[model samples]
Target: MIDALVNGLVILMDPFRMLMLFAGVAIGITVGILPGLGGLMGMALVLPFLFGMDSYAGIAMLIGIAAAVPSADTFPSVLMGIPGSSGSQATIMDGYPLARKGQAARALSASFMASLIGGLIGAVALTALIPFARPLVLAFGSPELFMLTILGLSMVGVLSGSRPILGIIGAVAGLTLGMVGGAPVAPEYRFVFGELYLYDGFSLVILALGLFAIPEIIDLMAKGGSIAQRGPGLGGGWMEGVRDTLRNKWLVVRHSLFGVIIGAIPGMGSSIIDWLNYGYVVQTSKDRSQFGKGDIRGVIAPEAANNSREGGVLMPTLLFGVPGSSAMALFLGALLIFGIQPGPALLRDDLDLVFVIIWSLAIANVMGTVICLALSRPIARLTFVPFYFIAPVVLCIVILGAFQETRHWGDLVALLGFGLVGWLMKRIEMPRPPLLIGFILSGLAERYLWMSYNLYDWDWVYRPLVITIGALCIGLVIGGIWLKRRSAGSAATASDNDGQERLADNRAGEEAQKGAQS
Candidate 1:
């Protein structure tokens, strides 16, 4: 095993292979900066060029693209309030707010640092777990997966902020939207309204861009200012961001591990890992006031998880030939093109290749982070550009992103519709994150529920993992409510103390006046 690891590293060190890896990282960064174009698109673009390339170099290039994207996508999410891809939607929660406060450099740097550390952690996990992960992967059956989806849904309460009812409404609305496509277990569709586009339901790109980006753009255009209200100077510089990540070191580790676990699950995609991490951090923190604002921790949590999941995603893809995501599916296809089958046989016969992948992922992450840090100052300056100057470009990019989802006119229609809905929700002070979370998880929940029911009837609920995860769901909800009440009670007590102090001061003044008159 040690020999294979060293050999893999040596192979990736060859000049041409290294150059291909660098090229992949550059392409990945470009794609990630454009809204909605993620690793999948980056991989697809490079696939044709790999036809007759050296197998090792080709694999290095693909791995580099995969590792770089989650890190690079942070650019749009932080600076413009746009989700560069589905994986980055959660970063907009606090990252864009930070940008508005002239902390774009801080946010961007922290995100890149967290991405670097998380990517390394994920690589370490992949290396350590590859030999022992088979049974762990098999442990999660349909019942367990359904419970996990429920666990994800339970986060809606925490994400809804001070308005639990509104949160519930938003989640339900999202579920309704997600259910519009073909039924998971049946042939019937719910809300197509006779349009063939509706038969496939809304694309995540359209939904995310409409909900987050369009509203911000509309408001910015109306408000007539740059994204950063404070102007060109970055209030918190790059070093501050690096400090913030280091300050929250344990947070980076926990969320990175969470990302890995979630990524390893076959059907769970990158869509919900960041949300889960965000919700967990909010739930566990004693001070929840800073979230959804410009809290650096918010930036850290999602960025860490977003990058780490790539390593976790490779687990099932390499071990069982089960692609965990669309990008992984592309990866599996590329493997087949190289005449390299993935599974137990590949593991036994080509362990060196597996290590090569690990090396590429780790190296790509380092390269991507260094490049992002070098570019952070210039890119972060975009926050100071006037909204009017920036709006048209952003609008064009967003529309193009949405249009590419299916290349149908309905994409534009849905983008406009959801944009209106998002604007209204923003006006009404309703939380949008819960809605996105609900939309992303609804299909998984329904599919798994049906699978569990058909396979085990009602008894699936009795499975140990199912019961365990269900307990976690209940605990999270109850704990969130309890923490909220505790925080409120503390505030009320502080207010009462202030009132009593003022009353005593007034009494003292009255006595002093009476004595002087006498």
Candidate 2:
């Protein structure tokens, strides 16, 4: 293993490969700084170049692009209250608050430092885990996969507030929509509704673009503003934040570890990992109450965890051929396009590629961090841009991304369809992540169950590992329900108490006024 890794490192020493690495990281930083253009879109746009290049160089560029995007994405989250990437959402809760309080530079610095450390940690983890990848891949089965999906769905509780019903409805809608193209068990068409375009049940990228990006743009236009406006005059020396980040190295380490573990688990992506880490920091810190309002550690934990998750997610992908999340699924496709099929053989036969991936991730992080740090001041001024220009450009980008998924008009129709759904879901307070997760995993779950039933003759359900995972899934679902009910009861009680207090004050004021009049 060490021999293979050393050889791989030597290969990366090529000036051309190094230059491509730097170029990818630089582009990734720019993409991350721009709202609505994320690593996935950037990679998709660049994928064509891979068709003409050496496999190593092609993969190297994509890896570099992926690594750098998260580093730059933190800037938008911290400075403009806009996520540079989906993974950076947790950073916005606290980071944006800090920026609003005139600490935009500080927030960006913390995010950059966190991304650097997290990326390095993730890269090292990928390298260390390479030897054991084969065995881990062999252990998982259909039942485990289904349980993992259920667990991922259980995170809706943490994501939604006050309207879990609406969230559940959106999730059900997504799951049903996911099933529309064909039956998972027998491959028979179901709900295509006589249209050839619906046979594939809507492209995942189109759905993602519609569900997340389009609605956000529409909402921005409806509100008549740009996120850039909120970020005005909020820039200065980021080095001070870097210094502050170094002082809190331990927090970053702990959060990175949290991210790595959560990310390693299949079905649990950065969304849950970030929120979970942020929640932990709030629970553990002395000044926990300062979290949502603007605490640096609060911002740092999520940024570190979000970046570190990329490493953790790649673990299963490189080893098992099973993706930890959607982004990794796209990466797996890229690997396949390069003639690398991920499985036990990759670990034994193509270990060099594995190491290259690891090292590339690290290099990308360093390059991306420096580039984004330098560009943050200018990017911060984007918040000052007028809404009229920003809205049209963002809408065009969203439509282009949606159209590119299948190169079909129906995808554009689907994009608009889901855009409306997204708008409605947002208005009703539905959590979007759960709906996205359901859309992603529903097909996988159904396929796995059918295989477990037919191939295993129902014995799969009785397997000890299956039983354990299933029970765990059930427990998570039950726990989610319990938390929801408990939260509702608390809110109900608070509402009642407030109403009573207001009525009492009103009566007392009336009585005093009558006495004065008499």
Candidate 3:
């Protein structure tokens, strides 16, 4: 096994292969930073170039592009409060906050660092877990997946912060919106309102833009300033981000492991991993009030988990011939065209190829991180630009991204409509993360719920994992409510104590004055 890995390094280090790998990495970075165009599109674009190419070269380029994207996807997520990809939705929670505080470079640096560490850990895990990966994946059934969705839904309570009522309303609103296009379990459309665009429903890109980016842009315009309202600096600089990530090194390791396990399961993609990891971090941290407001650990947790998930994504694809994600699905097609099939047979017959892919992923992660770190400080300078100059361009970028979903006028209409709702939601101080998350998981949850119902006729409730997750879901909600009430009570107690102290001081001063007069 070690010998295979060593041979892969030797092959990857060859000058010609290294050049191809670097080119793919560059392409991946570009794809990631561009709104709505992510790893899936990147793999599709690289497919035609694989004809008659060496298997090592083709696979290296594919893995190179795949591995490099998560590193650069942080760019828009942080700098613009727009998710660079669906996977980056959670990143905007704190990453954009950091950028708004003039720490764009720091957030980007920490994200890249986390991605690098997580990617390496993921690759190592893939190598070590290949033997047991199948059983681990098969352990999860429809019931388990449904319970997972419920687990994901629990995040709304965590994210709602001090406003659980508003959060519940926001999540319910999102589920309604998510159900607009087509029914998950049936053929009925619930909220299309008779437009052709309504048939496909709102794209996730459109929702992300309208729900988050537009609101941030509107606020920037209203405030008449740069994103970094403080001043024109990158804050504590990139090294501070490095130190911040190092301080949370154990967090990176723990979440990376979780990422690998979660990623191995189908339908549990980066969306689930990123948010779940973020919620876990927030839930476990002692000092969490700073989370949505530019905390460094917020940047670390999601980035690490998402990057690590890329490795887990590959395990199922290679071992089970099941693509773990859209990008992996495209890459799976590329493998077929190249006469490579993924299965136990492939692993037995093509051990070197498997190692080569894994090694390429790790090496590309290093390359991607190095490239991002070198460019981060300069790239971070964009946040210092005045808002009026920046807003129109970003608005156009988001508009274009939204339009790409269907190339219809309706996409723009949906964008404007949702944008207004988002702006209003912000004005009311309602947290937006829970809404986005609820919308994302609602369809998935409904699908799995239906599946579980049909498969086991409610007997799935008796399953041990389902019961455990259900209990956890209940506990999660209860815990969030308890914390909210406890914190509120503590604040009230402190206020009362302060008032009593003031009254006592006033009485003492009056007595002293009377004594002096007497």
Candidate 4:
């Protein structure tokens, strides 16, 4: 194992691979700073170009982009008041407020620094976990893996944000979408509707654009403002933000661990980790007043978590062929294209590729952080660009990018159809992440369930691991609801206390004035 890692590190250090990594980081940062396009689009954009590349080189580039995106996305969240991706949404809460107060550079710098540290720590943690990784997959038969899918379903409780029914509906919608093609074990098609395009189902690329990008394009163009609504204080806040990160070093480490832990859970690796970290920090802190009002800790926590999640995401992705997120789903596809299956066989034979993946993530995180820091000064200008101009180009890119995937007219129709649905979803706040998550898990769930029946009959339900995982899934659902309600109650109590204090102060002033007049 050590030898494989050393060889993988050597290959990553090769000049050609290093250059590709640099190129990928550059492209990732560019795409990440854009409001709607995120790392998923960046990876998809480059996917077609990786056909003839070596596995090491291809994975390096993809990891480079994947790791860099979270680091670079802070720019828009802090400066433009727009989340560069779902992962950065919590960032805008305090980061943009800091920018509004002329501290954009501080926010951006701290975010990048936290991202770098968190990513490095996550990579190291994954390295430590790799030796034990095989046992986890080996222990899980079809029953256990199927229970894992149900555990994934439990995450919808946490991700839905006060709308569990909507979350369930969105997940069902994804499962429906996943069912469009032929059944996993049967030859007959279910929802093909006689269209060849429906046979293979919608390409993930088209779904990404329609669900994530098109809605943002429509919103950006409609808003039609400079990306940054306020002047940024980039003049001297870089060092200050660095100092802030240093002061809050433990906070970054704690949240980074949270990111990794949550990420390792089957369906919990989505951007929800970012908000979870932020919320955790806010709830535990002695002084909670500054959380949503330009606090530097806000910038640090989410940045650390989002970046660390990428490394943790690779664990399940490599060991069980289960993707932690939609972006990772694409990664699984890319691996298959390279003739590498991602489960036990790959672990036994292509161990070096896993090491290569680890090295790429670590190096890319460092390189991406450096690149973002260097470009921070110039990219601040992006926040001043008019959305009207940016919108048209992004729309064209999404439409054209969809076509580039399958080179078919049906892709266009799917793009428009899902685009409208996505826009409506945003309006109603239906939580689009569940749709993607469920879609990714649906096929795995079906196959695993079928295999469980064939392998163990109905007795699979009594298996120890299956029962344990199932119980955990139930706990997650109950725990998520309890946590949400408790947090809401705490926040309400605080608000009421503040209101009562203000009322008391007002009455005191009135009584004092009356006494003086008497």
Candidate models: Cα lDDT each: 0.78, 0.71, 0.75, 0.79
Every model's TM-score: 0.59, 0.72, 0.58, 0.84
Rank list by TM-score: 4, 2, 1, 3
lDDT of 4 at 470: 79
lDDT of 3 by residue, 112-185 (tens): 99999999999999989766654554566778777766665564655566676787778788777778888989
Give me the runs in candidate 2 sitting further than 4 Å from their true place.
Answer: 3-70, 73-107, 130-133, 142-172, 182-187, 230-238, 262-302, 315-357, 404-406, 475-518
Counting only residues 3 or more apart in sequence or on different chains, how many pairs clash (N, Cα, C under 3 Å) in candidate 3? 0
By lDDT, the best candidate is 4
**Over 4 Å off, model 3:** 131-236, 377-518
What RMSD does model 3 have?
10.6
Model 1, global lDDT: 0.78
- Over 4 Å off, model 4: 14-16, 44-54, 80-82, 89-103, 266-272, 279-295, 336-339, 343-346, 482-518
Better of 1 and 4 by TM-score: 4
lDDT of 1 by residue, 1-518 (tens): 88988999999999999999999998888667755457865775566467679999999999999999999888878877777777887787778778878888899899999999999999999999876854554567778767765665665675566787897788788778889979988989888889899998776657767776778678768877544443334456889999999999999999999889878764344655766676677677888676776788988988999899999989867875555555775687678668896655567788899999999999999999998888766654543456687579767877876777678999899989989998899899997766765675677678888999999999998888788878877886777566545534543443454356558779999999999999
**Candidate 3 global CA lDDT score:** 0.75
Error of 4 at 33 (Å): 2.3
TM-score of model number 3: 0.58
